[model samples]
Each structure stands twice: as C-alpha cells, then as structure tokens.
Target chain A: MKAFAYVNATNEREVVAALKTDGIALPLAGGQDLLARMKDYIDSPDRIVNVKNALDTTVTSTPEGGLKIGAAVKIIDLYENQQVARMYPALNAAAIEIGTPQIRHQATVGGNINQRPRCWYYRNEEFVCYKKGGSRCFAVDGENQYHAIFGNDGPSHIVHPSSLAVPFAAYGARFRVLGPKGDREIAASDFFTMPTLASVLKENVLEDEEILTHVILPAPGNVRSGHYEVRYKASHDWPLAFTTVVLTMNGNRIGSARVVLGAVAPVPWRSKPAEAALAGKPLNEDTAMLAAEAAVSEAKPMSGNAYKVQMAKTAVKRAIMRAAGLKTV
Target chain B: MSDKEDRFGVSRRDFLKSAGVGGLATAVTSAGVTDVEAQAGPRVIGPGDVPVSLTVNGKRLELRIEPRVTLLDALRNRADLTGNKRVCDRGSCGACTMIVDGRTAYSCSTLAIDVQGKQIRTVEGLAGANTLHPVQQAFCDVDALMCGFCTPGFVVATVALLEKYPNATPEQARRELDGNICRCGTFVRIMEAAMKAKTVAGPPTRQARWGDMGVARG
Candidate 1:
C-alpha cells in the first residue's frame, strides 16, 4: 500500500466534511475491502478519513414499531441481535453468511453496502475495465465466467458485491444518507443502479461527500422472509447465486412478495414474474417450482455464466420453501 | 533443505523471549506523558513518520511509522514479532490474524495508526519465556503443524475461537477457523489440537470510561 495521510473524524458532520476536502479523501469503515484495493493499487487515495467511530453503530426500535440499524454496526452484532433474529430472519441470515466469522466480526454494515465491485478484471490493476473509465469492458469478450447473467445491457459487467443489499432490498429498507447539504433518504431498492455507459463509474448514487449513516427498516408486518445462497465452497466464499424472498402472508396465501437474486446480475435482480406468480397463490412445492422457473426465465447469461441461471432458480425455490417452514435441500 | 535457512529462521516465540528483557525496561513511562496526552486531541497523521504506541502483550512499544503501515507489517518489520506470518497479504487468508481489543481481526487489513490505544495480542503474546501456552502445547502434542509457515496465525485464531466458545461444537469450530487456509491439509489434526486445548481466556481489556465509548476518534 502507498503511504497516505490519515484523518480521524469525530462525528457524522466531521465525516462528511472530511470527505469533502480536496485530494480524494476516502472514508475508511472496516478497511477490509478498502485496504485490499489499496494493496492492489486499485485506489490510491491521498488521505483516509477514519469513519468507523464517526457513524452510529446502534440497532434500536423505531417509533413506528420498526427497526433502525446504524450504518457502522458490525455484521456479527447484526446477526446475533435477539430482536433481529426473531423479526428479520432474512437480514440475520444474510449477515451471517457474508464472510468468515472474523470478517463478519470486523466488517461493518455500511462498508458491506458501500463496497466496490469485486470483478476480477476490475480488481486487477491491469485490465482497466469500463468501470475505471477505460476504453472497453474486458469482460465483454475476455474470461467472463463470474460476470453478470442478468441486467447485461451494461457496458460494464461487474456485479454488486454486497450480500446485505439483497435482504435490505427485499425488506424495503431505506438509507438515511448524510451529506454536506443534510440528510436525504433513498429506498434500498432504488439505491443500486443498473450499469449504463454514462453511470458505469459507480454502482450507487452516493456522492463522494455523502455517507450512508443509517438503514431504517419498517416493521415487516405478518411477513415470511427467507434467504438462501449457493456457494461452490460450502465454507466461506462469495455466493455464486443467492436469493431472498419476502412474502406478506394472508393466512397461508401470499398477499405480496418480493424476490431478489444476487451474483447473477449487476444489481440485485428483482424477479417481478416470480413475485407475480406468488402474488395470490399459496406457497407450496408446485407454486415454488413455478416461481423458480419464472425467476430465471429472463436471465441472459454470458459465455461462461449460464450455470448461474439454474443455481439461481434452485436458490429461489429453496428460499421460498425455507420461508414456508418446509424441508429443503 | 538449506542449512543456512534452517539456522536463521527465528520464530516469534524465541524472539519475544529474547526481546522481553529490553522491552520491559523501556516501558517505564508509557511513551511520555505529553505524547500520550496528544492522542486525546485531533489526530491527523501526514506524509511523515508518525509516532505510534501499541500495547502488545501488555508491553508498550513506541515506533515512528507511516500512516499506511498495517499492524502486520509494523509488528513484523518494526517490532520483529515475526510469529504472525504474512501468507496472503490480503485478508483472504488469516495468516496475520491477531486479537485486537478483544476481537479476532485480520491484522493485514487493520491500520496501525487506527489501533493505537487498543490492546493487541499476537501469536507471540500467547506464551511466556519458560512455558508455552496451552494452545501451542496442544499443537505440539497433537503434531497439528507441518512446515509451520501458517502455525502462528492458526494458533492465534484457535486461541480466539476457544475463548469465544470453550467447548466449541464442530460447526462452530469450522466456521471460526474458515478464515485461515492450510495448504498442508493438516486440518484434522489442527482441529483436534483446538478441541483439546483448554478454554484459554485473553487478557482483560481496559474498559472505557463511563459515557466515553461513543465516538472514538482514531
């Protein structure tokens, strides 16, 4: 890593102000992803603003009978919170399955959601993919095995690398963003943008001076939610395919549902067809199979990622079954 | 199998035992009163050699380093605490795992300046001069290590896991040790050593003052 200056921010205002300073001051949360990028020379900032202690790290009950999680809360604490384990199982499940226990212990929620893309081509300094404002996206023709299979209209093919974003999007959470202008809230679903020729530089709309401070989750009233991931390494590896399902139940019938898939797209691909299939139908094996098929119906895989379509379908079906209290493989 | 390589490869355990005499002698005043007091104010380390004080193994060692130095690099290069190996400099492999502020963390990813006042316990901190820590002794008795490049990191991680879950279940053990990768495939024996080692507790961390745990700057 290159030698850079370090500034420690004392509070939220200081964090935003520090980031707004000149010379590309990047906020350091857990430093798990940022340090790796620095070592790889992907990002060589002049100064690092330590924001781990600057952001709120609490998880408390909101006035609306919902849960409000501070952006800096560690992943382990989020997974082990008794109320979170009881109320939001999908969030808890995603938190636990993120990385190894040591990583989950040190990595923060804000860092997880704000992490950069993990494309091998992008992570390597030589490729100079489109995300880096380069001439072309190497994944277009080069070894694109782990590239996106959905939302492939992109000039870039890097997948969003947050496991928490899947469940947070499924839960309809909103982010309380802190910026120099003040706080603004953005829905979790709309926070991630599809890659375009114009907006290929960043995955989220968070400006350089803005910080995602809090994630406010409205109470999932009478809802059944589940999350399942398919990793080639059954141990600690990034998901090859994952799915999260949140269904508002009306006495054994699905009133509304949100199904989101990860690692198969640039953003968390919400399968509207799967949600429509589970709209008024009862969740059983047949309906789950139908929803699974609908989830992968529109997957446009690249050359080496066609297998993710089937794995995503299995993950969708298993997530629905797990949400319904059924035995799943 | 080179004779020169075998003779000069000094483990952190032996290095610490040798350096303990000189380190404790210099720890008389704790990095000077004014320097320690400067930590409470605003900290902005710049493109110079910044003074950093670390409480490693209950001994305070002061070093002037750059802000970009990681804890692993500082300990190994500056302090000569080479017990913690640097196998996979990224956080993927846990060769540089160390206990910081009562939590097991990847020292390769943790910046040295960011962890100034926190208590750090590395693999070298586990044993004493005349005796071995139970975890180390168990590894030896069970023949859990081969080639020993990754032993110190695995030992530190095992110490953390056993402290968190004394009688760790098989699943919990697997999950906790997933961060460390062993190419030697000595996992069965390593897990056996972890299970056999007694529930060892880490040194008690200094509790923050009342109402002072809120925004820890640097």
Candidate 2:
C-alpha cells in the first residue's frame, strides 16, 4: 500500500476544507471498501480524511413519515434498527444480504451505497479497463459472467454493487450532500453515473469534494416494497441478480409500480416498461410474467452472462408478485 | 534559574563531552532514540507516523504507525496481542477476527484508527488466568483446531456469534462463520464446537423463558 497523510476531521467544514487540497484526499468512512482499494493499489490518495467521526450515526423517521439515515450508520445497525425494520423492511433485508456479519458490522450505509463497483477488472490494478481510463472495458470479452446485462451501452460494463441502493431508488430516496458549496439534496436515482470514456476516473455524480451526509426516503403510504436476490450462495456474496419492487395497490389492481434490477446494470436498472405493464392491472401469473418479460426486454447481456437475463426475469416476476401480495415460486 | 548557568549545574566541558559525535551516533543507533542535533539536515520521518489510539483487550494503547497499518498490525505489532493472527491480510481469510463493540469485525480490513474508541476484545482476552471461555473450552473439547493458528480467531468469532444470536441454527452458524477461513478445513468440528458452546452458554435470557414453556397452554 502507498503511504499517505492522515487527517481526522471533527466536523463537516473540516472535511470539506481538507478535500479542497490539491493532492488526492480520499474520505474514509467505514474503510470496508476504501481500505480494500488502497491495499489493491486501485486508489493511492496522498491523504485520507477520516470522516467516521464527523457524521452522526443515527436513523430516524422524518416528520413527513420518511426515513433519514445518517451517512455513518453501520449496516448492522440498519438491520437492527427498529424503525428501519418496521418502515423499510426491504432496506433491512438488503443490509443483511451484504458481505458478511463482520463486513456488515464494519461497513456503513453511505459507504455501501457509495462503494466502488465489484467488477474483477476494476478491482485488479493490473487490468486498466475503461473504468480505469484505459482503452476498452475488459469485461466485454474477458470473464464477463458477473458483468452488466442492462445499461451497458458504454465504455464500461461493471454493475452497481450496492444492494440497498436499489430499494432506495425504488422508494424515491434522496441524498443530502455536503461539499464546498454547502448542502444539497439529490434523488437517489440521479446519484450514480454511467461509465463514459470522457471521464473514466469518476465513479458517481458526486464531485470529489462532495460528501454524502444522509439519505432521505419519501413517506411510505399505499406502497408495498420488497427485495429478492438470487445469489450463488447463502453466504454474504453479491447477488447474481436482484430485484426491488415498490407497488401502489388499488383494491386488487396495481395503481403504480417501480421495479429496479440490481447487479444487472451500471446503475439500478429501472424497468419503466415493467412498471407500465403492472399499472392498472391485477397482478396475476400472466401479468407478472408479462411484467418480468418487459423488464428484461432491453437487456443486452455480455458473453458468459446470458444466464443473468433469465435470473433477472425470475427476480422481477417474484418481486412483482411479492409486492402485490401474491404467491411466488 | 539563570540562563547563563547549566540547568543541572554541569560544566561546559562535561556538556560538550556528553554531546560528542560518538554519543550522537550511539543515540541515533539506539533502539528508540534519535539524535536531533547531529544530522546535517533536518531528519524526516516520512509519511509513516500515523498516530492511532487502539483500545484492545481492555487496554488503551497509542501507537504511531503508517496509514497502511491494518488493525492486525496495530494489535500484533504495537500492542503485542498476537491472538488475532494475520494470515490473509486481504480480508479473504478470517484469521484476524476480533470483537469490536460487541460485534465481530475483520481486523485485517479494519484500520486501527477506525476502532479508536470502540471496545476491542481479542482472543487473548477470552480466557481467565486458568479457566477458558466456553468457546475456547469447547474448541478444545471438540478438537476443532488443527494447526491452532486459526483457533483464536474462530473462538473469538464464535463468542461474538453466540452473544448476538444465542440460538443460532446450524445454517445461521454456517452463514455467520463464512467470514472465517480455516486452511485445515476443520469446518465441521468448528461448527460442532460452536454448537457445544451455545449449549453450554445456554439460550439468551429473553429466549430462556420461551424454552421453559410447553407446547400446550392451560
């Protein structure tokens, strides 16, 4: 690992001021991902501004019935939080499905959502793919088994690694960001960025100086949400394909719906067509199948990842049925 | 108290003799001492002194180290707590499992500074003077360890699991133990040891009442 200066920022202003330096100054949250990246030499910042002590580690319900989760809230805390488990069970399930108990305990919600992609090419310092400012995306032809199947019309093919962000996006969550300019809120859907060769070094839309403070989810009313993940093993591995669904029910018919597929795209792959298929329609076997089919219609799977298409469809079908209070296989 | 006189009332010749080049070189070569005035230029420590305070095994130790110094290094090197072995520093192997604030964490991935104020319980802290913790005793009883290098981490992780989920099922045990890796493949025996420890520790206080109740009500 490369050597770096360390700064312990005690407040948000100190954190932002430290980030304004000329040299690379990485923010250390839970260090679950940042430490791994440093060890891999993927990131060698000249200074690491520790932010674990700067943020509040609380999760509370907003006056408008939404949830406000601090950036430093650990994933284990999210699983054990009564408010999160009661109001956002999908988020709780997603938290439990991350890495392992040890990693979950050390990893924070902000770090998990802001985590780097888990693509093998991106992680290994030896392979300088487009995500690393090289020529092409290595996963396009190389071992592309876990690469993206949707939203891959880009110079990179890595999938988003956050399991919790999918539910957050499905529920229309917003981010409270702090930077040199001050605080601002952004919808969760707008937080991520598609990989473009124009700027290969950037991961998300947040500027290098910006720090995510909290995530705010909209009020839960007439909305049923759930998440289903298909993984290789029960042990805290990343899901091969996962689905998060938020449905508004009108008597027995679906009034509105939002279906987001994780680990299948650069960002959370929102299936507007699938949502349209379920809108104003009773969620039966046929409608669920149609919605599942519609969800993956735009999927362009890379080599060795054709199975993801099927897995994604099954996940979407099960998630839709689950949202509608129907039985799923 | 006079500026012209030596503080200890030593002569100038004696002070010059004590500050000789030989003495300066000896100071530079000493284990933990450095000669500040003998160098031709200001000595630089490099970006290698990252000061971190770690509370490990019920002791608060302050160490100046590199930013890359993992919690495993801070524990085993600075604090001299070698119970948490550093097998795979890349976080794949679980030889460096330790309890931080009532939760099991991979010390290899965890930075020492990150766990400054938290309570860190290493495998060394699990046993008393002569008696062993239930998890440690069960490991010995079931012969769960082969090389014994990974035993400390396994025992610590087991204690953490049982503390959190006292009645963890076999499948839950497997999932919770996924972070720990034993090269000897003593997983079955380790599972047995964990289960045995669970029984010896008994169910948690909340679940004990349910355990006393029969199937049928009055």
lDDT of 1 by residue, A35-135 (tens): 88889866666668888878888999999888999888999899999988998999999998988877887899888988888899878866656665555
CAPRI classification of candidate 1 = incorrect
User: Number of backbone collisions per candidate, in order?
Assistant: 0, 1
Evaluating just chain A, the predictions reach TM-scores of 0.99, 0.97
Interface RMSD of each: 16.0, 18.7
- Best model per lDDT: 1
* Tens digits of per-residue lDDT for model 1, B1-218: 22222543322222211111110000011111221112233356775789989999889989999989999999999999999989888888888999998788899989998898999999989998988888887788667899888888889989898888888987788888888888898899898888778533543223422365573442
Error of 1 at B9 (Å): 42
RMSD of 1: 13.5
Candidate 1 chain A — worst ten consecutive residues by lDDT sum? Answer: A16-25
Candidate 2 structure quality by residue, lDDT tens digits, A26-74: 7788788878877876666666777788776899889999889988898
lDDT per residue (tens digit) for residues B129-157 in model 2: 99889888788766799998888888888
